[model samples]
Target: MPQKFVLRAAAIAAASALILAGAAGSASAHVTVSSPDAKPGGYAKLVFRVPTESDNASTTKLVVSLPKDHPFAHVGAQVKDGWKVVKTTEKLPQAVKVGDVTLSEAITTVTWTAAAGGVPPNDFDEFALSVGKLPEGVDSLNFPAVQTYSDGEVVKWEELAKDGADKPEHPAPTLKLVTAVTPVAASTEVDNPDTLARVLGGAGLLLGLIGLGLGLRAGRTRKATP
Candidate 1:
């Protein structure tokens, strides 16, 4: 009987660990950035994936901060149903230049408020942004976000993890700008990378056509001169 009890206890402990591992990697995991086209000096579709970790409270609001060190010239939010998104702008302490364009103000924070039903406990949602002229200086951008729950609980996702295994308790969502880097996979309520790929492909095609036209024009000019 003693041996049987020990075996049963060990099996239960293993099962619990599996459940936690699954949660940590899935629907109840950290808030993350899903960027398919995050190359430097290009426009990108950035999606913020928010998961409600609370067991009893519903997530009602989210506030994401855009760092000033790495700034974007333009920022816009994707419209999501059942949620109201507000982009808040603040005057920069110092004027920053972006590709010959000077700006005095910038969007510093984005907030999403639940309109109807907030994200229930253990459920997740996604918020998106369309930002242009991503800075070419940095290889990555960090976004610090806050999650508010209906039960008067606030969780801040702002830790900057050094590595995957050494991740802090609440690691902030980060987007890697290098095009070659493979992003970590996530499950549920994230933007589709295929849609972003199509948009970028169309842009590439347009540029190619423009280049071809310019080349042909130059050739014609040379022949006419001779």
Candidate 2:
């Protein structure tokens, strides 16, 4: 091959590799929520997990904004050691149910600040809150997040809302409320009609093709020789 052609092919391969690497890096930067469950008119512990670009620099601080429309939106958070918790309340149009009681409104924002010279790089921290009395007539919750980086970079993990949806731009984490269903019974393994027919059909076609190829080769060899 010509030297120029070889160099061009190498450059194309390098470009393709770089493109793939960039795509993978972007996918890894998403923030996720862990350990979430809420029962209607009940309290639960919600934990938010924030993964940084550089785990080396510990996550300095995290701020979670509660949804105003939620029943327990203004509920207070349980205090944690080694961190300072700040709560901001907001007024609501109607009352929200907490257990047997109804609350007029709930806290709007909850921020957790680390101690001075806080968590170092390359480490993770957990922010836990005791949430009380989830609202009624809701199945799922979506918690939006705002993450702060050591290098003065802030990332917002808020998604856009859809039509006729109760979702917010940067909503708080959510939980699913499901009723338990009992299983009826388990079935023994039996050959599936469609799958079995397909498997047999494929095997027969493969064998037929192999046989035809062998017969043609044998006939050609005979004609080529004596």
Candidate 3:
């Protein structure tokens, strides 16, 4: 009975370890955005970090799908050495502004293709770009990306939620942005002015009343006893 109990305990421990390992793998597979919050009417430098699989194959290409309805959809990317960059443009219904400039069309997609053996196993790369003149009313920006492996397998990261939920199966690149608001100024005038004035005024009034009462009592005592 003792030996049987020990064997059953070992089997349970092994199953627990396998479950934990699978959870860790799923957590590590999501592609993440590194920079540039999507803000309206702002200029930002955006970066997407790509991690290749740790086992055998390296990442060969990264394709980022830009949002069609973004105010600054006409996007351009900074070129990287030894990597081929491609940009595809699309039309927009409205124009966005950055400072004093107005922008109409924007780039819809950007792709970065690595040279042969550029990204190796257990390594990573960053795709960066200079973008500006984002429109004013977006809370978050989502980029669904396609990551290609050397063996022709593709991983899609493109799940977004309105309620900000995380998708365990496929995750997309995201950026949270905040708009600038006016700040309140500190007041220097009336921290304790009313309290100080009331205390002093009440003390003076009480002393005057006490003096009058004492004078009347003294007169009455003199008149009755002398």
Model 3 pairs in collision: 40-135, 41-134, 73-106, 73-107, 74-106, 74-107, 75-107
Residue 195 shift from truth in candidate 2, angstroms: 31
State the lDDT of candidate 2 residue by residue for 1-226, as single tens digits: 9999999999999999999998785545455554455566677777776555674555666788776667463355657677788887777788866666677867767887766644566445667777766666776666677777667777777775677997454444554665446444323222657767888999999999999999999999999996
How well is each residue in 129-199 modelled by candidate 3, as lDDT tens digits? 66766656677788889999888889999866546666556778987777756544323333357866888
Q: Sort the predicted structures by lDDT, highest score first.
A: 1, 3, 2
Q: Which segments of candidate 2 are over 4 A away from where they belong?
A: 1-29, 55-57, 73-78, 97-99, 161-172, 184-226
Give the clashing residue pairs of candidate 1, or none: none
Tens digits of per-residue lDDT, candidate 1, 67-108, equal 786667899998878889999998998998876677788899
Q: Whose TM-score is higher: candidate 1's or candidate 2's?
A: 1
> Each prediction's TM-score against the native?
0.68, 0.57, 0.61
- In order, what lDDT does every prediction score? 0.86, 0.68, 0.76
Best by TM-score: 1
| Worst lDDT 10-window in candidate 2 | 181-190
Once fitted onto the true fold, the runs of candidate 3 whose alpha carbons sit more than 4 angstroms away are: 1-27, 36-39, 93-104, 162-166, 180-226
Candidate RMSDs in order: 18.4, 9.1, 12.1
Native-to-model Cα distance after best TM-score fit, residue 216 in candidate 3, in Å: 46
Query: Lowest-scoring 10 consecutive residues by lDDT in candidate 1?
Result: 182-191
